[model samples]
Target: MPSPADKLRALLAQDKLHVMPCCFDALSARLIEQAGFGLTFMSGFAASASRIGQPDLGLMSYGEVLDQTRNIADAVRIPLLADGDTGYGNAMNVRRTVAGFAKAGAAAVMIEDQVAPKRCGHTPGKAVVAREEAFDRIRAANDAKAAGADILILARTDARHEHGLGEAIGRAAKFSELGADILFVEAPRTVQEMETICRELPGPKMANIVEGGETPDLPHKELEDLGFAIAAYPLTLMASAMKAMVHTLERLKSGQDRTADLMDFGELRERIGFNDYYEVSSRYETSRRD
Candidate 1:
């Protein structure tokens, strides 16, 4: 299998921006792959919200995230890049971060330059570690992979808000020097800042396209032109799903969540691979003699 990093790097070297929707599980990954996208991302925001019912605070551990990444990777055939928030603490922690995710079948792992108990990049009032500290973290991740060539090390900086965009770009440049394959400068609030970053950063770059947040929607083509090789639309599917779930629950509480308001069971089944469900159930339903 081509590593997600390899695929991403190859795509970056090409003519346009690649759209990678964020996927948190096997089902979503399979759906994205079936939809014919070449890239998929595992977002910390979605992971925490879906699995743990919590914020993207550093509260989630490496082991917890590892389990989720494993399930998602096993569920799909495509390369997946995962969020390793703050490397779970320091450079040493990053060694295990790479090893764990690689074992779980992640094609790439993204570690951010944030303090412990990391918050989502889009969330307000974020801070970052020193430049040298982030550099060491990347070095440790790279070294730990140990010619695990298929696995990629992505360096992300939340420094855009804390230290300014220029410093973030400078950090990205240094991260590239430290052997990071991809750079994620989290949350540029303006198109101009984004364009400046695109022009300034010397290595491969990834963009976070979060609707209704610090990032406004830009046509994928425009971002590609600006030099973002990959754009991760984090939280689209999960956010939409959550909205639907809330609406459905509200309808039910109001005695309106009926078949008329919902898709037929057959449709629901089809969407979740219910036909496959029947085939498996049928085989097991019959006795050995039958």
Candidate 2:
């Protein structure tokens, strides 16, 4: 069977924009595959918010994120692209992070140019590292990937806000030259900037579309027309799930039963593969009896 990385590379070779939905947990990952998505992204913002009940201020540790990545990857066959925030340290740390995520079954790992304990791209008060240091991190990731990680390196620059679009484009070009398989210029505020990034970036380009983010929420067709290879909606499902859960709880407190509005009990069980476990149990029982 082809590996997830191989599958993703095949998809990228086709002449269409790949849409990767952000998955926060194993259940969400499974649902994404079931819904016929070819790829999925594991967002640090969504992971921190869902797992630790905290903002995407880089509070989650490397181990926490890796474990989550493993679970999500195992839960689905589709390729998973994971966020490796500042690689949890310097260049050496980036190497280790690349190896770890690859071992955890990630098809692609994204390392950004933020300082340690990086903030979300959509959040204010963000700061990036020096150019040399950022370049070193991407180089390290590239080296790690080359050393049999079998994973793609997504080099991201959060410099559009702190430095400028010119600086971000420059950094992206440098990263692509350094062997990054994909380039992500995070938080471009306008469609024109998006077009410029896609046009100038050397390799396959990624466009991040967070709800209420700095970037314009252009449609997927428009993004493809701009030459973007990947359109990542990292916070769409997370935000929607939060709102639905909050509304459900509020209705519950008001003495209203919304069970009928949700998935039926047996169908939910089947969705999670309860019948598979029953089949295994039946086989074991038959073997014992024989």
Candidate 3:
């Protein structure tokens, strides 16, 4: 069987845009796979919210993030791209972070240029490291990949927040020069800026689409026309799930029927793998042997 990295590479090779629905947990990852999506990213913002009920202010520890990655990766056969925020430290830390995610069964790991204790890409108070430091992070991540981590390096830049789009593109170009497998330019405010990013960057590029966030939520076809390889919906599923849960809670509090707000129990069981588990375990039944 092909490795997860191999599968991701194959998808990137195709001359089309892939719609990636980001997942926060193993169940969400399984749902994405069952929905027939080709790829999914483990969004740090969503993961932090779901796991700890906190914001993505770089509060989640390295171990916590890696454990989440392992569980989500193991829960699905499709490739998982993990969020390795700031590499958790310096360039040396970048190496360990990259290798750790690979060992955790992630197909790719994203290393960003944000400073330690990074904020969400769409949020304010975001700052990129010095040009040299930013380059070092991608260099170290690429070095880890070269040393046989068997994973892809997703080089991300948040310079557009503090600096300008020019600076962001410059950093991403250097990352590509340093051998990043994918390039992500975060939060381009205008369609023109998005166009410039795709025109200037090389190799597979990912566009992050956060609902009610910095980047415009363009349709997949338009993003493909702009030369993007992947269009990532980082918060759509999480936001929709949250809305449904809150509505259900409100209905229950009002003494109203909540069945319409829920999934069927039988379908939920199958989605969670209970049906498959029983089928596979039947071969070991003691009664069958008798």
TM-score of each: 0.90, 0.96, 0.98
- Give candidate 2's error at residue 261 in angstroms: 3.0
lDDT ranking, high to low: 3, 2, 1
Ranking by TM-score: 3, 2, 1
What overall lDDT goes with each candidate model?
0.83, 0.91, 0.94
lDDT of 1 by residue, 159-275 (tens): 888888889988888888888888888889899998988888877788898888797589988988898888899989899888888888888889874556577887667767867
Best by lDDT: 3
Off by over 4 Å in 3: 286-290
lDDT for 215 in candidate 1 is 72
Per-residue lDDT over 1-290 for candidate 3, one digit per residue giving the tens place of the 0 to 100 score: 99999999999999999999999999999999999999999999999999999999999999999999999999999999999999999999999999999999999999999988999999888888999999999999989999989999999999998899999999999999998999999999989999999999999999999988878888889999999999999889999999999999999999999998789999999999988977877888773464
Provide the clash count, candidate 2: 0
Model 2, C-alpha of 29: deviation from truth (Å): 0.4
2 or 3: which has the higher TM-score?
3
Question: Which runs in model 2 stand beyond 4 Å of their true positions?
Answer: 286-290
